[model samples]
Target: MKYVVGLLLALACLQAQATEEQTVVLISIDGFRHDYIELHGAPNIAKIAEQGVRSEGLIPVYPSKTFPNHISIVTGQYPSNHGIVDNNFYDTERKQRYKMGDGVKDSTWLTTLPIWNLAEFQGVKAATFFWPESEARINGRTPSYYFNYSTPAPNRQRIDQIVEWLKLPEAARPRLVTGYFSIVDTMGHRFGPESHQVAKAVKHVDELIGELWQRIHDETEVPVNLILVSDHGMSQITAKDMIDVKELNIDEELFEIVNASTRLMIYPKEDVSADQIQQLEQRLKQKQGNFVIESEQQLAQLGVTDGPRKPAIVLGTTAPATFTTRPEEQRKDGGTHGFHSSRDMDGLFVAAGPAIQQGTQINRFSNIHIYPFMAKLLELELMTEIDGDAEVLTPIIR
Candidate 1:
């Protein structure tokens, strides 16, 4: 018995040492379509694959929008659990609306434990550089360090900042870090995915990533694990696919769309009116034509269901098109996501580091499942195994 006890203590000490040696860096590239890396535009991303694990696609959480999916990546929970149903949604119960902006100020609204919070509990320090909802502390606790969404800040600046943060003193250093790049998604919104504009954005972000990586490899003493991921994939759009919400007499009471093109938040005026809500869904179907209409309940079962604050129904722009809203001008012409997690909505995920497997593809896994992959990479204990199901990515780890 003493021998067994001694072995257990030895293993515990070894485990703690292993955790201390690990470092994880998460790079979230927005609107990173699965093809971006393979399309010859994102060479840096391709290089990451050469060095580590690559996936055919990283399925996004349901709703397949920015806020919901991005939140899912850190919390390991679906929108239903993390509470960001869409970029913006009206809470049927709260009788209030929640946008990605001020909606997440209260950390308690989130049911699942975020990766940063979990890392804190384990004595690991974590940081977020421009990740969504990172601007403020939740439950009066924030990451070891954080940078809010400074949209106008240049990408180079953001990259430099992250590189600089990694070089902080040992006491100030973070064991895990997450960063964001929104140019691709921003460009996708301005021009369709196939447009030359998007190609340029992809190239630009790729270079930014390359610069950021050179610094990480050159500066950091401890080897770091990097995860390059995206919240959702992008879809091409044309002026033809644009929807004129004014034409539908949309219920500002029923639906409030923040992201406009990729996703929508639907609410019915005057408490749970079934007939009106059905009509609203039908109206959207007529206007958009062939888009998938997902009620809150259906979305939950699909693995990306949102919280109580979400609207009545969510729609996916399914055609070989996109979504946009403009009143006076063309009233159209933009790309978007927020579609279902089908082949059309496939996103990006790539892992490169000491532990990652090289020259291979991970099966279709959602961003929520990224937690297990990250936990394994950085060697951290999950807050609780209940956020979502994610494989530990043994394929990448030797």
Candidate 2:
């Protein structure tokens, strides 16, 4: 009788341990253009794509800057709902500047729950490698483990660290791991998406992906899954067309320039005028097509519209066009996003694993709807309405 009772207890413990080892790896290549995956140097990603399902382009959130879109991707919420609308904005509540790098204060401001929080609640260990806001602890603390944003480290080193984590015993193993790299986006902004430097960046990220794929298989078969996605895409802004806001008679008080490119954001001063706005547009010195300025209402209609953190007006550079407040000082690699995320600026996503069907393409996925799918992948409860529910992906699995 004693032996039977002991055996029963041992079996229960073993079952619990096995359940804890189910692993998922999610990687994000920032600013990875949708078209770039199949070209130049992304063969590994291509291999993954061939084996799984992918969206033609992963649409980004409004003001599709880094922080908001990233939180939305994982939490399944829009910037408005998720609390991060753009890179920099005037916080009405705090009535001050808000940037993603403000570690302590910003972390507390995240209202919606993230997948990491959900996974932890499920008794699953989740870890992240340099994901935006991942280091910020909410409720109590961050993921089981995480690294702050550090693009300076060699990409291969990040892969090595992930492999190291996999070596832990199943009971202690983290069930989910996320990684990120900025080289492709960095190169695109500097040399344009079509430039040779961008190609090199593509190759570098691809090689790292290949190394990770090889390492995971070579090390363990612990029922691991992989999801690759990007926050936004890059648009090249030529120097000859760069517009300097400083030269324009726009209300210095009516708005503050955040960042410029095909899309420029303008935060209105405390009090402004409509006729004054017209004058600024008329006197706006420069060649036309240099950049198009949009009123607050117009921006709201385009879906590029933002919320309280958003400015009253937005300036958008058309395709292949760019703008800046100070073109001379923005940096040689000076580039921009925050566009309407039209077909021209589509993002990227790929899922290759047991959780998804193989060799499938889902035509109708949107940037907002990816969260529900992730909820399905992690077996976690959904926190917000996934805008990406146009059609659930039916690939990457049997």
Clash tally, candidates in order? 5, 14
- Give the clashing residue pairs of candidate 1, or none: 80-305, 80-306, 91-309, 254-267, 357-396
Q: Estimate each model's TM-score.
A: 0.85, 0.84
Residue 320: error of model 2 in Å?
2.6
Which parts of model 1 are misplaced by more than 4 Å? 1-20, 249-265, 271-288, 295-300, 304-307, 320-325, 390-392
- How many clashing pairs in candidate 2? 14
- Model 1 per-residue lDDT tens digits across residues 1-398: 99999999987864664455767889898888888766637888788787878888888877788888888898888777777766766666666766676634665555666788778777888888888887556656678888767788777877887787788887878878888989888888787777788889899988988877778889876667778888888776666656554565675755555444555556565665788878777777776564566655666677654445656666656645444556547665667787667765788888776555667776777677787767766667775655665454655764
* Candidate 1 vs. true structure, TM-score: 0.85
Look at candidate 2 and tell me the lDDT of residue 361.
78
Q: Write the per-residue lDDT of candidate 2 for residues 279-365, one digit (tens) a residue.
A: 655664243466766665765653443456665555666655565655475535435566766754677888776555678776634
At residue 238, give the lDDT of candidate 1.
Answer: 64
